[model samples]
Target: MRLSSLLFCLCVASFPVMAAGQGLQRSGPMRFLYDMGVSDTDTSDPTMRQQLLQLREAGINVLSLDGWDAAAFQKLLPTLKADPLFSRFKYVLKIHPHVSSNWAANPTQVCSDAANGVLPADTAQLLDGVAAFGKQNADYVVGYYTFDEPSNKGVNNGTTICWQYQQLVYQRLRSGDPDSTDRPVITANTLYPVAPEDIKNSVSPNAQDIVFVDQYSTDPAVQATEYKDWGNMLKKVVPVFPAFSNNITTCQDPMLRTQFRPAVQSGLNTAYGANQPAVAGIAYFAFYPGRTYAYDAQNCAPIFNSVVDDLQHDPIPVMTKIEPSLNLILSCPASSSTAPASSSTSSEPCQ
Candidate 1:
């Protein structure tokens, strides 16, 4: 093994063994990006394997299976679990029932269906699949990504059903796993601004256990303020995971791209310094190449290569530097039905 790879393994070995359903309880902070963009077709590809190894060495400990449903994950997990390189990182699996659909194509229709309880059976089956998968692969799994940007303007339009949908998913997941101790439900909100009440209403103890807030702006000030604002706003309601923008579409300028590191650093500083709610971890908006918004459906080889290059140069070093100071504050205990008491302290460098 390479020196860095050896070091990473040794470091991972030193951390306490993670118990099922406690969420990611690493010694250092959980550092991950949005999606690996892996599909069933390329699960056995040699080049894709190498790229995953490179990402692990690049300081990302968490791997997100962004768009994969339960069946897709079931088929792919055995192959991934057997691979030494792929098995090294923890995963956040996507379990949303309508993951393959385009929410923007017809928000009203989608929202109406979700509101009217059109997919309860589908949702229950998906949750059961995930719960079974988690029991079988407890070590590799961390949480479930139940929805993405549910209240975005052009997406769910902050509909009451959209918010209720989150509650339904959360309730079902917990009903099966009892407190989601084995695997908590996670959701990501849009980067676009929303009202504070709407944001609060969208999240509840009965809904997502953890919430990822995405804000992409080239300016460090904008990144810092918005991320801190969102963190402060939702920290008490749910554990917050602040996502940084590595997506090139928004960060077109090369110099501005370099500013991402400080932007994330400053955001963490302000959020923790102000004594915000429990910040579970940090995440990048994505690792996929090309524009994330465009949903580029290209070959996996070139896309994986581009992602490897981007990681080797930019976000990896930022994560390497920032990760050390981020200590996991496990003082905030997990609750079965209610939100955990806010136990985050400003004394710790990062939480």
Candidate 2:
């Protein structure tokens, strides 16, 4: 744990990581990630385990642990960390204050100090947890999910609050690391409901480090239109951080063959064209095995597993190609959603 400038250059990944000097191109594979239920595979059941192993067999390498008992991680960590192929699997820890609830659980319910225009101590604890976990499991940990789509009602300077809180936790992460452990990456998959202005003014692309967005438009044509719109509006930071866009919950509206083909093709095209710092990948939301976040797959959306299967195949290799260099550039982005400029500062790895 040397506390100096550290730049790791990995040479063998399924995808070819773009050189820092090279701008975004139709580079390697996009990262294949599963926004799982903490233990996407069930904690108690081996079926999820089996599916994950199968995914690894198929070349999948990233998993976003949504919500589940954090305790479950202790048990699976060893197995996940042991597999050489899957060992370096990038993980996102979507944490909950009390467990089992997502940020969107109840907007009316108080979230954290940041939600109320103030910094809360609990935010530090959450960041600390992520940092501690990253240190314990270096190869498997990747990003920290600060908050999932926190803008249903719309708030002024929402990104500012988000940045401030993330910075606090990031400070703590570092403080604990007298050894300067690898900082966890931070990103909040903000819903489009929140204005880009909120994120723009709040995040310091370089300070916040890594970032992700959630744009779920089922209409391929409409979605493609929106991606171009985003590319135009966001500048400065995006081209530097990791950006993730998700599909709107499919259960809300079903996609037809016509709708699906264009949506998939155009959406990818638009993202690729955006030319952000690194469009590491794209992800869908409320992903589950048998059902959708709406809790109804057939109601309107495609089954969770089916969609993942399709998206998973194409991106795995692309990501593999870029893995070598990407693994290092994204190394220490303050996670827990902090922006590294604040009174609420600590050294906990925020990502």
Candidate 3:
């Protein structure tokens, strides 16, 4: 769709109240990491429980249940509510109409149908399910992740299909629960080198609530520049989460190969700019061993153990030390004299 037309759609749509710094303000400063490397249904497994404890001790406050849908999360919610270890951390839950990894080969059918003026029955049902799930679990569910790394390859005529698809998803989700201010729709896009305009066009308040920029470059300069650029570009449009790499292979310093200290530092520096926290929070790419390209082999028990051990001894401690400062910056309202111009309508400080 033409940029102007897309924006027109956004301007006309009836949206829910999106508080400033939505999730960050509501939940406090979040230290997010992805993938539990266990089945969502295995909430009671002794091994999973131990891992959950380890993550909590490591100062990770938010977990992403990426590959799970509303049904799977609903099934696991009981355990999350009952178990103190599980309940300690807030969660980012996934919903359906997901964009496929191999987008070129297998285009998202729903987006295509959407462009053709069709709302497939199954797709509507899935969105309804997500709305119901978000409403029921708002206490622990901080955000609803609907798309990951959507690209422009799936374009119809002049419009990006995924863009239209995301807008539809957002509308359906909001229509289901207009009063909700939490559980904003989220999308995790691929790393930088992508134009800020394109990023804004694809993921913005019009389509999704927040965009998690996944940047895993090992070079500190690249990390710093890309994150700073993202902060500058999206700060006025939508809140962003810097999803930095926690995989050891991406660590530049030999001394910190087993720690994510540098990654954490860079993310915080950019997100917590001198004037205000530009981004919402810092998110680690993957906590599970095989989730990243650096460690692609699945079911490697030894590697998993090594990763858990590294978290316990290294980066977690570093994060724990500075968490208080992080929360202060994240939760405190920006000074009236120093506050940057924001698109958010609410003037209330982030709690």
Candidate 4:
């Protein structure tokens, strides 16, 4: 569907807040996740937690970890695991350097044994180590991202990397005691011309996993093309699996300059993230700076907390104000989960 079509349905989203996401899942609203990786090391910062607390109270339940070491990560875990703000919110952590080799359980552990290599570089061993660590933190773990942006030209290898990472977490997930009611999710970043192997060879999206596609396009037309050619087409092959995604965070360095904000603020991204004919959601570039502007969700400003009120104070308003006209969107239900099933809630947020 074209952006024009989305413009039409935009009115329905603005309807009175009723429970939505019946066929989709969850209803309160899709996540306005501000990437929370910056606070991974700075455990002493009361301000970040305050922002997160604001987010939690506001109904945003998902928090994606941007970049950080497994060790420095530990200092922050207690708060995330215990704090009501983050305790129940979904947490996605990206292992630094390389998703596989770098994020081990030990704080002292580094994925790279040599500056040139990341640990054994053995795909199996690397997957195993990463899986074991994720299992320990499985309670809060929403998914494991193997690589930030893989440089693979071959679709098969591109897909192989995808499956290899899945196997790591899956095996550990089966072996570990469950804490969350959700299934394990894995993601790999691939750019356009995603080879057939990459597309065809990866894990089955139907197997209750997300076929996450991370892109960094800034052009609205290009973003629309991504929805049509990349996201829309992939859904035909794997409908349920290609449901969640993000723009790889659009940004420059740390914080967005006033210039980039106009593009992000434009309805393009809001539309693309909401623009699916079937089932899926889009997360913006990122929350803070220091990474790439391409990852920032709210590109208009660099300091995320000040503007996070959009997600925290008035998420529904933000969703209704700026969004694609699509019908299906996923969110957790009103009832608390006992199964750790990764369930898509049909009810709106806690309210």
**What's the TM-score of every candidate structure?**
0.60, 0.54, 0.57, 0.47
By lDDT, the candidates rank as 1, 3, 2, 4
Highest TM-score against the true fold, candidate: 1
Model 4 alpha-carbon miss at residue 172, Å:
7.0
What candidate 2 gets wrong by more than 4 Å, as runs, is 1-32, 39-41, 44-47, 65-76, 79-90, 96-119, 154-162, 170-184, 195-207, 218-274, 286-315, 318-351
* Best first by TM-score, ranked: 1, 3, 2, 4
Better of 2 and 4 by lDDT: 2
Task: Give me candidate 3's TM-score against the actual structure.
Answer: 0.57
- Residue 153: error of model 1 in Å? 1.8
Among the numbered candidates, top lDDT falls to 1
RMSD of each: 12.4, 12.9, 12.4, 13.2
Candidate 4: which stretches are off by over 4 Å?
1-34, 64-76, 96-139, 151-181, 193-208, 216-220, 231-282, 287-351
Residue clash pairs of candidate 1: 21-181, 21-182
- After superposing candidate 1 on the true structure, give the runs of residues whose Cα lies further than 4 Å from its correct spot: 1-28, 66-69, 97-119, 157-161, 179-182, 195-201, 218-220, 224-233, 236-258, 268-272, 287-351
Q: For model 1, how does the per-residue alpha-carbon lDDT over 173-288 read when each residue is reduced to its tens digit?
A: 66666635335567666544666666665544456766665555545566556655465335311222222224434422223224444464455455455444454444544332
Q: What is the lDDT of residue 179 in candidate 1?
A: 37
What overall lDDT, based on C-alpha atoms, would model 2 receive against the true structure?
Answer: 0.38
